[model samples]
Target: MSIAPARIDEQTIRALPKAEVHVHLEGTFSLIDLLTLAKENGVALPGPAATLFDISTHTDFETPEVTTGGGTGTGSAGLSGFLRFLDWQCGLVRTPEQAARVAYAFAARQSASGVRYSDVIVNPTHWNAWRGRDLALMDALSAGFDEAEQDGLCRVGIAYSLLRGQTAADAEDAVARLADASLRRVVALSVDGDEKTTGRTGEKFQNAFAIAASAGLHRTVHAGESSGPEGVWDAIDLLQAERIDHGVRAIEDDALIARLIADGVSLGVCPRSNITLGIYDGWASHPLPRLLAAGVRVTLNTDDPAPMGTSLEADWAVAADQFGFSHDDMVGFARRSLEASFADDDLKRDLLTELEAVVTASTAAEVTA
Candidate 1:
């Protein structure tokens, strides 16, 4: 039997098959993984080990003080600051084995959150240790993910990313190497970083994205977050982006919102990340529900779950608890993520079938209860 979308139970939302298309592998570091990797690599902690990754410094969710941003371009406050943190923590990897372990752990975490498939972003710029060995890096990550897939963990594809701070030459060089690498795990060519710090970059990297497209890699861009709606326009028009990461700022331009609806481009949105980074005031002010109501394809995600202390389910809870979204609205968001993923059609179909059955059972349980 089919399930109705009226019930807003926690069990059904937790059980629904999910797809995370915007998560960063650099940001998936759990406290245990951090310690294990630190010990293995002899990386010193910048502060007290126990509270090094605390959310208090990163967010003002419960406090009365209005903490807008985190750090500077070189520090840890705004989008620029957060990108630097990603670079710092991601540098702990000293070998292919370490890279594999990170990828394995990423898939396992996603599986724990009911994510059946994921497209994880890994910017080579962040991994200083893996410098000159990106091909081997992708291979290592793919090997780990392959092992996880064998064990029924979340099936993963890598969205190889270039930091926005890189030059046009850097973009060209990265794409050329990826085109020649023949890595099966590399699914898309993505560009992410602090756009506000870099200014307009679409015109500069247009050729690079074209090369990636020619090489059969999908295109995704991080825009409409650090910058304004103009950045998103550049992503779609110049970069030919198939999907956008953190395109929440599109709400600023009604024309852009209509364009997104017309072009059918899905956005991978991280609501909590926005709040932590000082983009939005709080959950109530987030643009997620409005974006959905406007007929825009919005996919729920945890942008940097570990550092932000959030999960896919936690983001969905924002829609339910904060916005009073019905179960149907929440399910629609989950389904959009699955549909937006770069995963194979067969896998997506299987995941959708699983989702249907779980939702049906959960709905029935809720009805009887």
Candidate 2:
């Protein structure tokens, strides 16, 4: 029997109100935005940033070693290409002002994409060292958050991220900075970086998690993306994350799946990021459907709009097309996202009501026409 294709209109899907739970602040930079920022900041582009945005450019798989340590190392060639791309990105974002500019532009672009609310991950450790001023880095990022919220384009929140390579002292310092109630925009603390750099050992950043939890901040950790389902367990057992980012691999273990369902933990599911990183061969083979069907609370997001060439709408389409999700399923995903969001109860209820109206109107239009 032939499989049915997912029926979703790109334009209509773009109009859907959605909450993005796993987007990275720096990762949202579009190729056009990156180029403009580079020129405005007097930074040089390695090549044309625009070319990376071209969907037609087939990655050269033969020359695997041309690039260094980036991309989806699923194949030798893809890994090399990713590394080269990372080098290009690193070259462009060198100062605090550049980071702020990227943040402002990213919010504008995401606003245009119809995202009503978003919680973006920000890692200041690497950028701080890059700019050689810890206080300056925080101030610049805080400014970006203030500007985005004031514009009323979207309700923005920050997840102050801890790098995997940081020492215990580094984590302590990060927590201390976040403990300051003056930074009211920061809603949570997260761990993000090379997963291998910080495993389940819990020695490096355990104190950081404790600090965040004590400060009444939400906790999220990146696991099971590069590692397997065990990484998911480690995050919960060690870091005590209320949510797991890219926890798709949790499907590998039955007990783990049961725990996730019973505990009501949220998974920040990024379908395009998985396919681009070779976690799943393609969207058709991704485990999002299985997880959702199994009663796991899954929310959609764009890990990086520019790097992975995806948006929140594109992610919903992938779910519909690849997983055979119905219109109700799409609405359910949106509701799940809002429920899992860090937004206050009042805002959450309001967004859910608005989303219900959107679903109703779309369904009514389809039925009438």
Clashes of each: 3, 2
Off by over 4 Å in 2: 1-6, 49-97, 126-135, 201-203, 364-369
**1-369 per-residue lDDT for model 1 (tens digits):** 976445355555677897999988888899888788888877776556677676334422212122112211112344543554565677777788988899999999998888999999987766777777888889988999999999989999999988676779978998999998868989999987667667888999999999999999999998898788999999999999999999999999999999999999999988888888778889888898899889999998888898778788877876677787888777787788899999988988988888778778878997999
94: Cα error in model 1, Å: 0.7
Clashes of 1: 3
Model 1 stretches astray by more than 4 angstroms: 1-10, 55-81, 366-369
Number of the top lDDT candidate: 1
Q: After superposition, how far is residue 226 of candidate 2 from its true place, in Å?
A: 1.3
lDDT of each: 0.81, 0.71
- Displacement of the residue 26 alpha carbon in candidate 2, Å: 1.9
* Candidate 2 to native Cα RMSD, angstroms: 4.5
State the TM-score for model 2.
Answer: 0.86
Clashing pairs in 1: 70-77, 71-76, 71-77
